[model samples]
Target: MHKKKDNVFITGHRHPDTDSIASAIAYAHLKQELGVPAVACRLGGLNDETAYLLERFNLDKPVFLKDARASLDEIEMDQPITISLNASIKDAMDLIARNNRSLAVVDDRQRLIGMVTISNLAHIAMGDTAHTIDLLKRTPVSNIVRAIDGELVYESKTFDFNGKTSIATIAESKLKYYELKNRLVIIGDDIESQCEAIRKGAAALVTVWTEKISEEVIQLAKEFDCTIIKSTHGSMNTSRYLLFAPNVREVMTTELVYFNRNEFVDEVGRKMLETRFRAYPVVDDHDRLFGFVSRYHILNSHSKKLILVDHNEASQSVEGIETAEVLEIIDHHRIGDLSTNKPIYFRNEIIGSTASIITKMYQEHEIEIPKNIAAILLSALVSDTLNLKSPTTTPQDHIIAKKLEDISGLDRFEFAQEMYEATSNFKNKSYQEIINQDIKKFYLSNQEVMVSQVVIYHFEELDTIIDAFENEMDLFVERYNLDLLVVVFTSVVDNGSIVLASGKLENAVREAFPGEDRSFLENVVSRKNQIIPRLSTAISKYVG
Candidate 1:
């Protein structure tokens, strides 16, 4: 999978329409063809019209992205260095020394259970005293043998040690003074001392610098249920190694502060500031260790790179747009409130659809426009221009549409009819879905206004649903916290629209388009060219 920072996401505005979705897909394809790692993404669900076009063209829907912020998955992290919970402390210390970082202690399933840092190991190696034997009791025999580099001469069927550890001296009288009950005793090769340690209820005996134990001593150990280990190290080294031979689980920190790989880097950084640890473990959804993320990683991380299509307004763009690096903008609308820190390649034109601009780009580059791409671009141009009927349609749009129609080998008029028919069937849709299908939010004179447009073949279809549509519009205003909400139902056959207004500035809609009823506009079909300009002017005048 490509890292998030390595891929440039080409996305349209929120609640994308056919033109928005199509322009992003085409631009991303062009960028990829030029060897840039680009991906097409959408901010919201697909409308019926856009979905129909994609299915007809055999194109997959773009990935849905929630925001444009950098996440931990994009940051460079240390590879996961892990140790098992049952592993010896020496093993953890070695791993920490090699990586110079804490190790994630995992269970049998490789799920993170705790963390062992260098501090935890140092405490065990230097400061541990009274509880050292208590810890060793929980440690396994295999760990002790591996820690001390010892051999198990006699293995008890059930090896149980009470945690007490002592060294038996060469003097037999001194051995008597040493309490060896149920304890692990480290001593020299004196056969009598070894036998006495086994008989005195000692759980295990380790003979330091001894290659072998006598058969008689082994027999006595078996009878007394004592495990005999022959260590290659001297007494001092064997005792020191034994002290740290316990499983790392005894020293690891069970309560840990970790982050999920999908977490936003800024959020993780904020959490890290509250703690003093140098690094924190990053895990997957299943709590499996993914890597370690430190403050250094967050400080060096880069924001997501983006190339906008169709719209440029911050309110209409993806969430976290303020934190993203906008590389380019290919749009047709009058510029909205989005600004980039660095100068970028911005292409904005007075055309009917952004698809027209992208179509020209393919021609300018002299690249062969793929058949499927041409088909979707033609659909977007037809939908946005309303088949050359909407006032936003330019002569250039007509020229580009013809070029796309020729390459796609599809009749634009027939395809437009089919696309409109697919969306006109509202029998299975809720009123909210129909209103939000092609909604756009605008900032007019310090007012948050929303305008939604729905196209139909005849005006009669809207007449049947006018009452329900008005009720839903009222709810839409309150739900979205809008200063005004307007729904325009346009009939392509009649070339007119019936407008309904709701919210605090409902009268502004009537003032924008004057009439006796103030609800109908003749020859007004283009929201970009006719509705937005008139509404903007009316809102400005109303505010003044």
Candidate 2:
């Protein structure tokens, strides 16, 4: 079943939830089943509840996403979404829908231009003013200047949305005035006042509104010898509108984050989660704008198709659900917003556990579930139904639980108890081991920083762990050669966390958190969910 990957596999929504976590793990397993390099990814930070669930199940969280668009320079971005912005927003939305989740990059003249995401257009419809100037930038100076018949004073007008046009440097003054600084001249206007204005250093001369020809005016022009011209837009329109019309290079977002034409879906997932921008512009290192990405792109992204189990509807399902190409939905919940590209083995009967539905699939295929997989599916059913306590539980859960208990050789009650205790003891480990364990890195402006977090059950552990964290951070920053560093502790049991971080990055942490009433936590209850957010918030406040 193995095949060389021609593209990346994507799954889920921007802000991932537990169902997203479980489904992604399952879907990735499905890909491995086919010998494909499939990965499940999420767009936003993990919530506290999700961390607890993942730890309880002993499942690795789905990687975080940077944007749907890929960054090709890095190996991770090699298969990034490469959609162009030359098309309509509807086209962009359609692409996002069809691709599960994809990175958006805008291009023109075979060069990466600016980024535009589905949300960017949505925000435009919502009356956001940020995109107005950027939209018109689609037409380059080459296009507009092609309409003009003037001397190429500044042959170097290749800049895109440049901000410096308002005040050209003295070195560039030659484009406007002549050497020796004599007053410029002009002619061919019926109004003497117009002629007078032209004579007063009028760098340009044009025949006004009609082609009012005059031999005398021509003679004055020959004497003064300044440039003369005629424009199709008419003298009034041209004189008033031309100069104010600046190129996109004057206002385009030059300092942009972008991806190469190729990038992988799995690799960039963790990156998208670490940063705050809902959509990072995809571009080459030369700084051209690509397409755009949004939170929805993650949900709808798909490089590898999936047959979903357990849940439907974006809210209850995993994050970046849209980013996955849904094959079939086998669930007990009511179907919500999910759309499939084609028909699949979808089974949404009124049942208890997805494990039940999956068990049926195995029976129909006559495929045996491996012992470990059976153990996991059984665990998923137990977590979702709470041992048949929830109203949604069905007889199938009880049956599967019994079968899985027999096959996996473990008592369900005993296993659940042991797992719960492990979840509670998940904290108070080595600070560096915890931080450098699963955390990722990104640069702000230009400074590199490392962020790590752990959630704990007991609040007192925060005080006990700070000194250890500080020592580890010093070594971490130096070892990673980072500019700043931070470690956070969250007590999901208390819905808050205490952060221990380098003084250099402390201000950044404060700005992200907003409220001043921060304290060192005794410990956090869910490190994955609670601590990472606070750490990221601090990073956003202080970093670029």
Candidate with maximal lDDT: 1
Each prediction's TM-score versus the true structure: 0.94, 0.35
For residues 239-345, write the lDDT of model 2, one tens digit per residue: 33333233323323334554443455555556677667656555554545434544456444545444444455554344445555566566655565667666776
Off by over 4 Å in 2: 1-20, 34-37, 42-59, 65-310, 314-325, 340-342, 421-544
| lDDT measured at residue 183 in model 1 versus the true structure, 0 to 100 | 89
**Residue-wise C-alpha lDDT for candidate 1, range 295-389, written one tens digit per residue:** 99999999999999999899999999999999999999988999899999999999999999999999888888999999999999988888889
The stretch of ten residues in a row with the least summed lDDT in candidate 2 is 162-171
| Model 1, runs deviating above 4 Å | 172-177, 190-192, 516-520
lDDT of 2: 0.49
Q: Give the TM-score of candidate 1.
A: 0.94
